[model samples]
Target: MLDARLKEQLRQHLDKISQPVELVATLDAGQKSRDLHALLQEIAELSERVTLRTDGDEARTPSFAIRRPGEETGVIFAGIPLGHEFTSLVLALLQVGGHPPRVSDAQAQRIRALDEDLHFETYYSLSCQNCPDVVQALNLMAVLNPRVRHVAIDGALFQEEVSAREVMSVPAVFLNGEPFDQGRMTLDQILARVDSASTARETERLNAMSAFDVLVVGGGPAGAAAAIYAARKGVRTGLAAERLGGQVLDTQGIENLISVSHTLGPKLAADLEAHVRQYDVDLMDLQRAVALVPAQDASGLHEVRFESGACLRSKSVILATGARWREMGVPGEREYRGHGVAYCPHCDGPLFKGKRVAVIGGGNSGVEAAIDLAGMAAQVTLVEFMNELRADAVLQEKLRALPNVQVIRHAQTTRVEGDGSRVTGLTYKDRDTDAVHTLSLDGIFVQIGLVPNTEWLQGGAVELSGRGEIVTNAHGMTTVPGVFAAGDVTTVPYKQIVIAMGEGARAALGAFDHLIRR
Candidate 1:
């Protein structure tokens, strides 16, 4: 359930709700936990218009139905609400209770414009911070358009359905029972899947051009910076990205971006895209580099092929393909992604404010996440697999300075412990004692390592790290002369945004330098 402070906050928010809302949970009384009943009972007491009723069969044992004030039709939640999904529960109630719609006019316009009968089934874990955003967007769309039906399924609760769909991640959406999206996505992106016209336009654009002076792959901070710099030099620059904003889109708090004191993921992503668009960058949107054929033409331009069947020839290619978080791959870890199991603390840490959380790894990134989480979380536990902390002396000192943080070295994470809905705790083993220990908490932050996105370079001579990261020299030149690299995808030690941007600038200059020399 919620702490008193949070309970009060919910109560306050509920006070403003003008309509009645009912959450009918289909659960067996004998199998239900006492804490759950108590929690719902307390929530029911907070507002006169809010009520929780248990009237379900065996099959629907944890399903939730959100009934509006007077509407006969209600949205369904085929999962329990806990962990990061607690926010989703509150959001569902607020939306169904006829609280003034929080959607923007453009969002409403897009919802209204939906021509197809879209049924969005979002498979989510309780701890997934991104899942709620996707669910809330879909929920809003459902409220707007009768044709649009949105249902949130707990991947943990309905394992059979998840396995049937092969849902590997949270925030996974299925459009008309087909796999749609697998991760956190913008609203425009979700619409693009259902909108045929939008897809056709993208197809046309990709088929139109097949050549560029400088081609930048990946669209993270590094890729965006490279594209902008290359285009400013008045060269025919092109940018191909799976999505406009790279990993920065998943990151939440971004205070270290120099002048910007504070910013969120979505805002930074939009800004990066806008900045890139301001330049003459070709901006091949939503295209991914699948294959690279080196020394293709006599002109020395390499032929780069995309998954979308669009081929582009580039005299030089800057590989700015970023890195993805290294998952622990433990039981319940994959099931609880976006739920309690989180990789980017910057993106999902805020969702666990005042909640008990654990940070895996004792490296700089782990310590940094612990320090960051300590600012808001009630308790921060730092678990390091190694005997000693690998973070810098300064960061270790900073982490030790926080009274709310406790460091546990020589601890190997065993499994993430969670109820059917959300994470309640985690189990780890003491490397010295070989004894397992469980710590009750709300969230788990994994800051182990970053795996670079360089799998597509299978047939190329691009020198890469043993870990598959692209290896490059000071001039951002890869093993190949015309081919360059930068960002997290490269073997750069620091994966910070500022560092990536700087590397991007250097790579663009290096490409220009190569052109002048040639």
Candidate 2:
């Protein structure tokens, strides 16, 4: 038992302190744990000025009201509260210690009135700066609403969870156990979505239309190529895309694309769009194809339906949708993207000149970016989740030779750390030793693999390979008559932009042949 005088002294000392102090205790079975708890309780009782709470088995605390003595508010966190976790604890304490961060009056009201419980799980890699703003927005929401529980898992730290969730992109936000948003989203946009989700009617439906000579689905490289070719060939082409430029728009440069030595993705896409405009192709920007109806007309035309209640009739169809980048799927990754996180080194690397940066993955793209950025950035850290880099030996030699480059093998990105505005560093865990370490950097580049954009066409008329690529014959003819596929979407064995364009040109010719034969 502690003496009354000692207990009183502890209480007096606690009352004098304004800031919150988090007590982090590691779980150990052999140690005298009961004594620690007893001391904590004694301190809590003697000092009416302090609040003491225990982390439960689940490492989470239930939402409860907390009022601190001599303070206007109180904050609570149920965790070990070490390393990066310590920062979160301090922020919570500050908020509860009568200096809560201010939000817009309207945002505060929206948060206060929210009665529903919202759980947000954001998957991210530390290398992606674009992820942080979304994470900040969600974190702000969590701060505003007690009903909102937000947990950021470093995708690299929790690979199994990431794979299970099928998260293939950084800044992927899951709301109420389902993916709600991906990439950077504004706070107002998120709030609007939450509001809409609460008040919107479920049965709301739009009118449908059916009828085109060519229905080009997707808006990426292949799709755009097909649209341009088909429209130029005098076909009534209707091109639908969720976003113009597809995956290529997110890319930084087109060095590998023939004829374009070092053009930006947006610029390349703009040129392609200009080419498409020269013809009479009907381009549907920000439109998604929800379904494909088989050929209903006697002339073998296919009916393609869009989510916007718009439809087009076409005798021939081309699937040109490209692929998507695979994600690191770590927590705090989605929330911190764009703020301090990033993916495309070519696009954002120059912005971080003479600054520290890290590249995740060991493929050709990853190695290439590291080598390229080594000349510009102050430091380049290359992390390969695998035991060795899969890049070509020449590139590997180049990366190894770079003085500024440091390679971390058998490591995976776990989390990204930053202010609400920009990325500052990243965390990683060793796959073999399970040792976790944080590396300070200004940027992160994800060079993971890509998944083909074929999920929408599953079980459709188009024949797909085991890897989800569209199966095409030598002439680019799909299994369905009058339908052709090209670019990376087809099983062409090569994913080069030149190959895709060549395939697109071939598909256009094949479509013409089908039209004439019919």
Best by TM-score: 1
State in Å the error of residue 60, model 2. 43
lDDT of 2 by residue, 98-158 (tens): 3555466866777667788888877655444444445556666665676876665445444
- Using all chains and alpha carbons, the TM-scores for the candidates as numbered come to 0.66, 0.55
- Listed per model in order, the count of residue pairs whose N, CA or C atoms clash below 3 Å is 6, 36
Error of 1 at 104 (Å): 16
- Residue-level lDDT of model 1, residues 1-518, one tens digit each, is 67899999999988877788876667655434344556677888999999887763424446766776446333677766676667767876777787767666865777788877887788876655567678877877776776887788877666667555655456778888787777787665676766657666666777778678899998999999999989988999999888888888777567899999998765788799889989888877677788877764435878778877778888899999898888887888887775678776654555566779999988878998999889879999999988999999999999988999999999889899988667788999999999989999988999898888888996655887888988899999898888899999888897899999999999999998988778
Worst 10 residues of 1 by lDDT: 28-37
Predicted structure 2: lDDT: 0.67
Tell me the lDDT of model 1 at 457. 92
Task: Give me the overall lDDT of model 1.
Answer: 0.80
